[model samples]
Target chain A: MSLDKEKIKHVAKLARISVDEAKVDSLTKDLNSIFKFIEQLNELNTDKVEPLTSILNQSLRSRKDEISDGKIREKILKNSPKKNEEFFVVPKVVE
Target chain B: MSNITNQSLSEILKSIKSKKISSLELTQEYIKNIENAKKLNAFVTTTFDKALENAKKFDNKPNNEQLLSGIPLAVKDLFCTENVKTTAGSNILNNFVPSYESTVTKNLWNNGAFLLGKLNCDEFAMGSSNETSFFGNVINPIGDHLVPGGSSGGSSSALAADLTPATIGTDTGGSIRQPASFTGTVGLKPTYGLCSRWGIVAFASSLDQAGPMTKTVNDCSIMLEAMSGFDDKDSTSINKKKESYSKNLKDNIKGLKIGIPKEYRVDNMPKEIDELWEKGKKILKDLGAQLIDISLPHTKYALPTYYIVAPAEASSNLARYDGVRYGYRSQKGKDLIEMYENTRSEGFGDEVKRRILIGTYVLSSGYYDAYYLKAQKVRQLIKKDFDDSFTKVDAILTPSTPSSAFKIGEKTNDPVSMYLNDIFTVPVNLAGLPALSLPAGLDKQGYPLGLQLIGKALDEQKILNIGYAFEKNCGYKNEIKKWWS
Candidate 1:
C-alpha cells in the first residue's frame, strides 16, 4: 500500500499535476500514510453488498432534448484565461 | 445602531417588516462591523456599496411577503455569485467570476437577501480547518489565534462575529457543522438532493450539500426554507413541494424516540465532549423526549470511507480546472500536457494536491476495486446502519466534533489528525441525511462545544424542532468578546 517517489510521480502525471522533485519524497510519505490508513477498509466483508453511487432511490429524471437557451457565447467565453472569437485557446495540441 | 448587528436574522426580519428599521440602515451597520473586524480575515471580498444600493431599493418598495426582505448575508466563497469573484478560497480561481449564479444563492436573492460579501473558506471546501484557504486562515472569534472550524470557517466566524446576521455554507464531510460547532453557531447540512448543486464549486458531487449557518436554530430553519427547492437544472434535485420548515416548526417532542448511538463514543474522547453529550441527553429527557441506546456498527469506518470516496470524486470533478477554461494558467509550460500539469501544480494548495493525488491513485487502473469500489460498498453499509437505527428512533444525537477549535498550525503537518476532526459529522453526509450542530456547552478553556442531531433524509423539520426545543432549555450562550475588533 505504500507509495514510492516514482509511484507518486506516476499518479501526479495521471492527475495532470506536476510534482517537484524536491517535494516528491515528502509527498510520497504523506500519500503512503494516507493509503495505509485507507487500507483499513479491507477489513470489511462486502461480497454481497451493492456499491452505492447515488443516495436517492429514484431514477434520473429526463427532459425533452431541445434547444433551451442560447446566443450568449460572449458570457461563456468571458472567464477563459486565453480565448479567441468563439473558443478557449490552449497550447497547441497537434503538431 | 451599534447593537443592531447583534440581532438574529429572525429578529431583524420582524424589525424590517414593522418598518422600525430600514434595510439601508441595517446594511450600513453591518458594513461598519465588517470594516472594523478585518483582522479576523473572515471576508475574501466585501460588497458594501452594492449591498447598500440593494437595501435602498428594498426600502423604496418594502415587501413584507418575502422571506429575507433585503437582509444582507455573507456566504462562503464556495458558492458562485453572478459577476462576483467566487474563489472557493483557492488561488486557481482567484480571478474567475461566474457568468451565472448558483441555484442556492439565486434562491436567497429572490427572497430578498443581498450579498454583503463572499466569505473565506477551506480551498474547494476541502479542509477541516480554515488553514488550507489560499486567501488565508480565518481566526475564530471565540478566542485570539484559535482556528475557525472550516470549509465554512468564514461563514461561522462572520456569523459569530456578528458581521453577517446569517450566512450559508456547504458541507461535504464536516465543512458546515464542524465549523458551526467550533464557533458556537448553528449549521445544518440538509438531505443531499434537497438543495440543488447547480453553481457550487464542485468538490465531491455526491456528498456536497448547501445549508445555513446562523446564530440560532430558528434562523437556521428560516434560511434553509429559503435556500432549498427542486431545480430542473440539477438532475439530482428532488422534485417535491417545498415544506414550510419555519412556519411548521413546533418544539413539542413529547414521547419522541431519540437515539444515542453507542459507536459515537470513540476512545480517548475528551472528558468535556462526553459530558456535553450526557448533558444533551439529560436535557432532551427533561423535555419529555425518550432517549434510547442504538448501534451504528459501521461508524468506525466512516472517516476512512470518506477519505477514499470524497477524494476520488474530487479528482474527477476538479479535472475540469485544466488551464484553458478560466482559472490560473502557468507560464512555464511548453506544450498542452505540460501546461495542464504546471497550471494545476502552481495553482492548487498542498492539501488539494494531496487529495487529487490520492484520488488519482485510487481510481487508477489497478487499484479501483481495492480502494474506490470497496469504499462505495462500505458507504452502503454505513448508510444501512443509519437506516436500521432510524426505524427504532426518530433521530440520533452525537457530538458535532471530537474536540473544540484547535489553535492555528496545530495539526497542519498531520493530515490524518486533521481528517479525524470530522469523525462524527462525516457519516451523515455519506448517508445523505440531514444533521444540525448547535452549541450545547463549552470546554474548560471557554471554547464552545456542539451537539448534533441526525435526521432521516428530507426530514429537516423533525431535527429543526428537536434543535429548537434543545436551544430553549440548554441555557448555553456564546460569550464571544469582540477581541479582534
Candidate 2:
C-alpha cells in the first residue's frame, strides 16, 4: 500500500513531526519501501511465538519505594524556557 | 597519562592523586584535542567552561577512591546534562536544554569525572551509522573517510581519537557496539535497566541502555563501574545492590564455556570477516576458554523485529516535542498546530523525519497489532534463542557486525543497508543481555575486526573479565590507528 498525502499527514501528526508538502511524494515512496520490507515478516509462522517485554525472565528487584527527589528547584529549573514561581508557563489553552 | 588516549581510569586517577596531573589540565587537553581533530565530529555541544569549573572542585574532594575521579569523560548527546545544549541529535530540541542530568552522567559528575563535552549521535539515537544526526554525520576517527559506527559514533570516535578518556553511550540497536567495532574501541551495552534511563533522551525505552565506550576494556570497566546502579526515578532501573563492574576484570578465563552461534556464522558473510571470526574462536580456545557450537536460528528476523519495535516506541516517545512546549517554535504560524508542523519540519533533518514518519505509521492504531505486537512476539523468539544457548555456554560469541566499517556514503542513500549494520548486534539487545565488542584482530586491509561477547542478564563482570583477558592476548601490534592523526 502506498502512502497518500493524507496518510503522510496523519502519521506526521501522530509523531508530532511536521511534514512539508513539497516532499510528500518522496516520503511516501521511501516509507512504502520500508513497509514492504516489514511486510516480509508476515510470511513467518509466528503463531507460537510469545510476546516478550523485558529480555530477563527475572522479576524486578524490590526497592524502598519512597518519594525522595532531593529538592533542587533552582538546578531543575535551569533548563526551562519560561518558568514563573516554580511552574512552567505555556500559551493559554482553554477558552 | 598525559595523552589520556589509552590510559585507564586507575592510571589517570593515580596521576591526579599524585599531583602529577590536575583535573583542569585533563579537561583542557581533551577540549583542545577535540577542537584540533579534523573529522572525528565527536562532540555536538561542549561544556568546556563548566568542565573546567568542575575540575577545580576535584582538588578539594577527599581521597574517596572513585574510579573516575578527575578523569575527562564524554557524554553522548542523547543524555541530558543540565543547562547544556542536550540535543537528542535532533533539531526539534536543538534549543532544548535539560533542567536535570541523566542519572548515569550525574553519577559520573558526582564521582568527580570531568564532563569533557557532549558527543554527536544519531538523531534521537535512531540510526546505527550516525548518518541521521541533525548535526552533520560523525566521521570515524581512525580514518576520516569511513562512517564512524553509530548512533554512538561520536562516543567511539571520541575515545578512538583520544578526545576523552572514556565516554558514555547508549545502545538501542547496536549503536555502541557497531561504532566501537568500526572505530577500534571498547563498547558495552549492559543488561537492560542496569543503567537508569531517566534524563537519557529515550529512543526505544525497553531496549535502550547507557554504556561505556573507551579505548580499552579496562577503561570500559572503570566507566561502567561508575554508571550502573538503581535509580528510583526510572521505573525500569533495576534495584539490585550494585556490584563492582571492575571486579571481574583480569579475572581468570580458564574453562569458561564460550559459545559460537552457528546461526551468526551463516553464508552471505564477507570472507575476511568469516576468517576473523574463526581467528577469534581460535584465540579464545587458546586462552583456555572452551568453545561450544550453538544455534540462534531466529537471528535473521532480529533486524526487522528491532526496527518495528524501536520505531514504534520512538514514535510515541518523540511525540512530546512540539512548538507548544519548551522547544523550538516556528516563527511563521497561522495556528498552533501549523506552528508545530512547521517547526518540526524545519527542525528535523530528512533522515530524522523519515524515521519519525515510519515510526508513527507502524504504531498507529489500525496497524499496531499487525506491526508492533507481531514484532514484540518475534522479539521473544529472538530472546529465547539467546536464552536457550546461554544454558549450554557460559558466554556466547559472535561477529559484532557482518563486516568492518563501510565507507561514509556507502549506505547513506540506502536505509535498509544502513539498518543491516546492526544485524549481529541487535539480537542481544532484543534479549536485554549484557554484550561487548573486543577489538579481536585486523582484517587483510588493516581494518579492525571485533568479537562480541554476550553474557547472562546482569552478568557484566564475567563479560568484562573475558574481554580483559582476550584483549591482553590480541598481540595488538598497534592499538591506535595511525591514520587517526
Candidate 3:
C-alpha cells in the first residue's frame, strides 16, 4: 500500500494539481504514512455490505428539465478570473 | 450597557423585545468586541457597517415575529454570503463573492439575525485544527499558544470569547464539535440533510452538515431551529417539518436509555476524559436515565474510512476550481492544462493538496475498488453499527474529543496524529446522526472538557434535551478573561 514518487505524480496529474519535484519526496512520505494507517481497514470483512454513498437511502428525485435557476448571466460571470462581455477568457486549447 | 456582550442569547433577545436595550446598541457593543479582539484572529471579515445598518433598520421596524431580530452573529466563512467574500479560509477562493445566498444564511437573515461577519475556518473545512486556514491560525481564547480546535475554530473561539453572542459552523468530521470542545462552547452537528447543503462550500457532500456553535445548549437549539429546513434546491434536503427544539429543552431524561459505547475507550485515553465520561454517566443516571453499555463494532475503522471517502469526493468537487471560472489563477501556464495545474498548485494550501492527492490516488484507475469502494462499504457497516445500537438505546454518550485542545504546531507535522482529534465525532457524521458537545468541566490544566450526546437521525430534540440536562449540572461557563483585548 506504499505510494512512490511516480504514483504520487500520477495522482497529482489526475487531480490536476502540480507538485514540485523538491516537495514530492516529502509528499510521497506523507501519503505513504497516511496510506499505512489507512491500510488497517483492509482487515475488516465487508463482503455483504452495500456501498453507502449517502446517509439518506432515498433515490435521486427527478423533475422536468427546465431552467429553474441561472438567468443572470452577468452574476454568473462576475466571479470568473477573466471574462469578456459574454464569454470566459481561457488559454487557447484548440490552437 | 458595557457588559452587554456577556449576556446570553436569550437574554439579549428578551431585552431587545422588551425595549430595555435597543438592537442597535447591542450590535454596536458586539462591533466593539470584534474590533478589540483582533489578536485572536477569530473573525476573517467583520460586517460592522452592514450589521449596524441592519440593526438600525430592525430598531425602526420593531418586529416581534423574528426570533433573532437584531442579534449580531458570526458565520463560518464556509457558507456563501450573497455579497460578502466567502473564502472558506482558502486562498483559492480569496475573492469569490457568491451571487446567491445559501439557504442556511438566508434562513438566519429571515429570522432577523444580522451578520457580525464571516468567521475563519479550515481551508474548505478540511482540517481538524485552524492551522490550515489560509488567513492564519486562530488562537484559542482560553489559553496562550493553545490551538482552538477546528475547522470551526473561528466559530468556537468567537462564541467562547464573547466576540459574538452566537455563531454557525459546519461539521464534516467534528469541525463544529471538536472546536466547541476545545473552547468550552456548545456545538451541535444536526442529522445529515436536516440542514440544506445548497450553498455550503463542498467538502465531502455526504458527510458535511451545518450546525450551531453557541454559549449554551439552549442557544444551540434556538440557532438550529432557525437555520434548518427542507429546500427544493438541495435534492438531499429532508422534507419533514422542523421540530421545536428550543421548547423541548426542559430537564427531562426520565426512563430514557442512554448508551455508553464501550468501543470509544481507546488506548492511552486521558484521565480527565474518562473522569468526564463517568461524570456524564452519573449525571444522567441521577436524572433517572437508564445507562446501558453498547457496542458499535466498526467504530475503530471510522477515521480510516472517512479519510478515504472524504478525499475521494473532495478531489471530484475541487475539480470545479480550475483557472477559467473563478478564484486564484496562476500566471505561469502556457496552456489550459498547465493553467489548471499551476493555479491549483499556487492556490490550495498544503493540507488541501495532500487530501486531493490522496483522494486522486484512491479513486485512480487501479485502486478504486480496494480503497474507494471498500471505504463506502465500510461506511455502510459503520452506519449499521449505529442503527443496531439505536434500536436498543435512546442516545449515545461519549467524550467529544480524545483530549483537550493541544498547542499549535504540536501535531501539525504529522497528519495522522491530527486526524485522531476527530475520533469520537467522525462516527456520528458517518452514521448521519445528530450529536452535540457541551462543556462538562475543566481539566487539570483548566482547559474545558466536553461530553458528546449522539441521537438518532432526525431526532435532534432528544439530544438537545440530554445536552441541556448535562449542561445545567456540569456548571461549566465559557467565561474567559478579556485577554484578547
lDDT string, candidate 3, A17-79, tens digits: 998999988898889989998998999888988898778968767778997776688998899
Query: Model 3 segments beyond 4 Å from truth?
Result: none
* lDDT per residue (tens digit) for residues B1-485 in model 3: 68878878888888899898998999888888888889899888888899899889999998977768778888999999989999999999999999889999999999999888999999999888899999999999999789899999999888888889988999999999999999988999999999999999999998999999988888888899999999989999988887778877788889999999999999999988999999999999999999999999999999999999989989889989997888999998899999999999999999999999888889988899999999999999999999999999999999999999999999999999999999999999999999999899999999998999999999899999888888788777766888878
- Whole-model Cα lDDT per candidate? 0.94, 0.80, 0.91
Model 1, B1-485: lDDT tens per residue?
56878988999999899988999999999999999899999999999989999999999998889999979999999989999999999999999999999999999999999999999999999998899999999999998779999889999999999999999999999899999999999999999999999999999999999999998989999999999999999999999999999999999989999999999999899999999999999999999999999999999999999999999999999999987889899988889999999999999999999999999888999999999999999999999999999999999999999999999999999899999999999999999999999999989999999999999999999999999999999998888788876
Where in model 1 is the C-alpha error above 4 Å? none
Error of 1 at B323 (Å): 1.2
**lDDT string, candidate 1, A1-95, tens digits:** 67788888889999999988999888878888888888889899999999998899888999999999999889988999999999999888888
> Among these predicted structures, which one has the highest lDDT?
1
Cα error, residue B131 of model 2, in Å, equals 2.0
TM-score of chain A by itself in each prediction? 0.92, 0.83, 0.89
Candidate 2 — which pairs collide? B128-B150
Query: For residues B72-113, could you state the per-residue lDDT of candidate 2 as single tens digits?
Result: 677899888877888888877788887778899989877768
Model 2: residue B455 alpha-carbon error in angstroms: 1.0
